[model samples]
Target: MNDARPPLPAPPRPVRRAAAALALAAVAGSAQATDVFRLEGFGAVSRSMGGVATAQDVGPAGMMTNPATLSLLQAGHTLMGGLDLVTTDIEVQDQATGARVSSGHHGSNRGPYVAPELAYAQRVGAWTFGVGAFAQGGLGTEYGSSSFLSRATGGLDTGLDNSSRLLVLNIPLAASFKVNEALTVGAGIDAMWQGLNLNLLLGADQVGSLIGASRVSGALLPVLGGLPDLRGAHFSLTRNSPLASGINAWGHAERIGMTYQLRPDTRLGAAFTTRSHMADMEGRATLTAVDGVAGQIPLNGNLKIRDFQMPAVLNLGVSHTVSERLQVAADLSRVFWSRVMKDIKVGFVSDGGGDLNILLPQDYKDQNVLAVGAAYQWDARWTWRGGFRIADQALRGSTLFAVIPATPRKHLSAGFGYAVSPAASVDLAWSHAFREHLDNTSLPNTSAPIGVNHAQDNATIAFTWRF
Candidate 1:
């Protein structure tokens, strides 16, 4: 019989979780796990080493990294796939000693990673057309143990040890049109989803504005076998906050970009992705315990809602060919995290219309990212490339992140591609992040708070194809 080798599927996942988790962990700590962590920048195979330079000549994947780059396609078909192994170990703050509470009290996420892309561009006269699909951005984290959440909320004071779970997902589709020899335009739409899980804290408020009586008929505490007097006194505060509800549904983000060729060897590109919005979530939370072991907490207090709008980003990039076989590219981008920081609002649709609100740290600092990379050819089938990124300040001032204190981050990356036959090439890349865990510590009533610090390290790999 003749030898036979069936075709294998694409890479396992295009999203690099190691880099994703590093970026997310660097975004915040245990307390504010939901808001601080963000998953973007997929297809690490390309952006991993450079500041996303391929955006110009990059076709399918370019829709995600740089849609404007679609105009630079040399008239052909292409496919790109990759995997991201992201693992995280996050710690909550210890209120008493101002130390990491417990390593077990952490957030770890994995799976649901697959980024596939396909692009075809043909020059019909002077105009070009292309379409592509990519995972774009999304991530998930399951934190704390079941016992942790129950224990934390059962006590009179639940530090930050309550169990927490979070998940987010995204898929975007993009298309481009070449208007002329030097000008191209493109647009995209992102379908995204998010979810979070949190337990009840014993005393949130005094129910000062509530209409019902403070005391109910039953024992605020519980009954334990053999210990009749063990069931002590417990209090129930008013669930007046409107942000405690659960959110489950779908939303979208918009992307638009333009690319133009300069004087011959030089090219420039720019783009903007609109913000994302998630409405209120619906769920229940109750205080469960036994004699001296539990309290009468309200699980289904009222309605809770939260919205995290990804900041609108601005990107500017320029690429220049130095010689026949040598080319270099650079990119500068901004993430406007300050927009939804403090101004973010959540309302109750079922309630009779009351003002139930809390103050979020609106002092989110601006973020800047700079990248530079170049490609070199040793022969017709071999090419080499590398790049780096210097990120802006991610953490604001004190009170910025009490439960979770994200740190400033920087990355060092490199990659290489090998041509297969005449129409295909495989790409490989690696990136490492060196982060300085800032001081993030707070006391129950410390007039002047203390600082808790930490650090991070991670790596990634990817592949690309051209036909």
Candidate 2:
């Protein structure tokens, strides 16, 4: 019945501090969410139904999902806007050292993240026109510059901050034609924008290794040894394009969708979104030289992120009314992730004044998502909804990192809506994914055992006005 903690083995002052610094930095700069950072749902009603909206015309979000559904909206002008509040958690443990650390509590600069959306649709003659702007998805994690990752390494004074953010936005203009009472077709043009900000610092130990192995050779090593070991080096080796000015790229894509009314209470829909061809992300990069090396090293005067593209997606859905006041729907989606993320490359200038590049192999696979949702009219002004969704992981073990944890495989959700007027209404929804646990020991280096547990919560509310 004894409950006590075991003391960790104490390494040298430098080793312990260095180990702690590297661990924190890696965790802080971890990749964004696993679902490839794609948001599950856009509007409150759709989110409440596990993002199953392909055939259901709940709001103006059709421009982002199934543009064909635009023609199905009641003849009028409709505006919809909403925001999502997300909470994420990441925890890591080093196997070689038995050291464990968390990204800090939920609210510790990591909690309550926000995403916004807006859509407007209008009917003119037989055509329905719509425009929408929204963050397709994003993932980010920030750790204080003075936290363990920095304190153990050298603190904020060294100008090494552990943080990363990846965001993608989409603006689409859509039009749908109602060919007949039974069918409608639509298409859209999307202006896609992507941006990234990453900062990773190598502590003294890694710096010393890099200097000894890459910079100095037999004769140079002996001479450099007389100066100083890189044990005191505080090198911000991977700080690239500040988010304000970093890798910002723009691209274009197309989407087509169709909706068919099979019966009085039944509908079927399909949609296809083309992959985007974006320009390479470029930015200036600088590195603090190995301590006592005299000056900073222009390692990457111009860093180029090569061949970054978004995947194409296909969706099939069905909606039906099984009872007088109840409707049910399901959607199946295919995300061609493997086609776009075979590998990630970073090209930079080497200290030797030559062009060099690093290729991080991804070898991702295609993934699928299946969602089923139901809505029940509880009263003249109230409706209740619930949904479930399951997805396949696209990333393989070789590509998984502590910073980029696995995406969740299961999601459970619930939500409700109220009609304030015939032309206006509001909806609210919430979803939760259980924690996903991962253990990685196969990384090339005899690195420590790295374990990460990730989980998330999403809450959304949207308003719709019909004019």
TM-score of each candidate structure, all chains considered together: 0.67, 0.79
Local distance difference test scores for all models? 0.46, 0.67
Q: Model 2 reaches what TM-score against the true structure?
A: 0.79
lDDT by residue (1-467, candidate 1, tens digit) is 00011332322243333333433332222111111444324444454435454344543556665565655655554555555444344444444445434323233222222334334444444444444444333322222333222232123333222333344555666666778877888777767665544432222221111112222112221221233322211112122221121444467778888888876988888888777765554443333222334433222234344666566778788878775445567777787777755432332221222223322334576677776665544346555555666666656544433233344256555556666645555666554444445443331111123343433222334444444
Top-lDDT structure, candidate number: 2
Residue-level lDDT of model 2, residues 1-467, one tens digit each, is: 00011222435577646544543342232221225667777678877777787888767787788899889777878888888787777666665566665654412333456767898999997899999887777666555454443322232234355555667788989999999989999999889888766554444543344444353223333332454433232222233332243566788789999999999899999999898888887766653334434432324355667878888989899999875556788889998999898766656553445554445556788988888777766545667777777788776754555444545656777788877876777889888766777676653211344666767788888888888
